[model samples]
Target: IDPGHGAQDAGAIGNGLLEKNINLEVALKLQSRLHQAGALTVMSRTSDTFDSLQTRVSKGAQASADIFISIHANANDNSGANGTETYYDTTYAAAHSVKLAQQVQPRMVSALGTKDRGVKTAGFYVIKYSRMPSILLETGFVTNPIDASILKSTAAKDRLASGIATGVSNYFDVK
Candidate 1:
């Protein structure tokens, strides 16, 4: 699991919330859930720390991870832009990446009660270079009031984590 940014790189900031922090919290919850589901997981960073995009890709490569999931929150100049979306790159594992996105996207919407921005194709560095089924989840737009409120809730975070974990399990056809 890869939490997008950290430390000096706070990523998107809005409504007094830091994207890095939210990403890490959700990732830690996801790690625990995956562990309970009998899957071994490796995190790019366990605490407030920064890793270059290349470093994150290397971690996934070194671990021989079956799939790479990068967790992040979104932000837009237009605060009205609010929803959950998943992105996949066509550079590698394109089909599997799309399948992974398909599994994950709706689950996030259900968990966060956010609008469905749907899955999309993007050439993000980590997902593009990972060489495995990879996806980047834009959990919600922190800049939007309604979305931010939902994202800031502990119960919602747990549900979002559970949703992501369940999606991953479904992707692998794991019980």
Candidate 2:
């Protein structure tokens, strides 16, 4: 499910790219691709509006989704740190989450040709609250010029979606 940041909270912003927008775009595309692959999908948000993190988690849980992935972009004050990273909840020992990250990270890096940031555990709200194997993927660094260009391109976005879909398919052991 996609978590759209709005109202008071603005996620990461750089090079006129907002994390919220990127999240929605990638989530929509991923949903479409997953549907094409015969996976049932649901989105927490379909527009540029705001919803609480709890609400997003509730929706996913209520749906009984097999996996929940929250899409996002990264930023840093340094403006030099750039890469793709997927995160899972530190408190959860879900093998599938790690497996999904392992499957997705290489594909994302291959498509973007960005730094391999590796996977890590974090107590992110979405990951923490999700019941199923969940991941929060930071697709790229918006503050970095090279990464920003890739993030802004439609081709790169499609590649990102396809890579993520491939990762999901791998995780589910679906051909």
Model 2 ranges off by over 4 Å: none
Best by lDDT: 1
User: What's the lDDT for residue 43 in model 2?
Assistant: 92
Write the residue-wise lDDT of candidate 2 on 1-175 in tens digits.
6755754566899988888888888889899999999999989888877888999898889998888898889999989999999898855546877887888888888877889999999988989878788998999998998899899998998998998899889888942
* Count of clashes, each model: 0, 0
Q: Pick the candidate with the highest TM-score.
A: 1
Q: Return the TM-score for each candidate structure.
A: 0.98, 0.94
- What's the lDDT for candidate 2? 0.86
Cα error, candidate 1, residue 35 (Å) = 0.6
Q: Model 1, 59-164: lDDT tens per residue?
A: 9999999999999999999999999999999999898999999999999999988999999999999999999999999999999999999989999999999999
The per-model lDDT (C-alpha) reads 0.96, 0.86
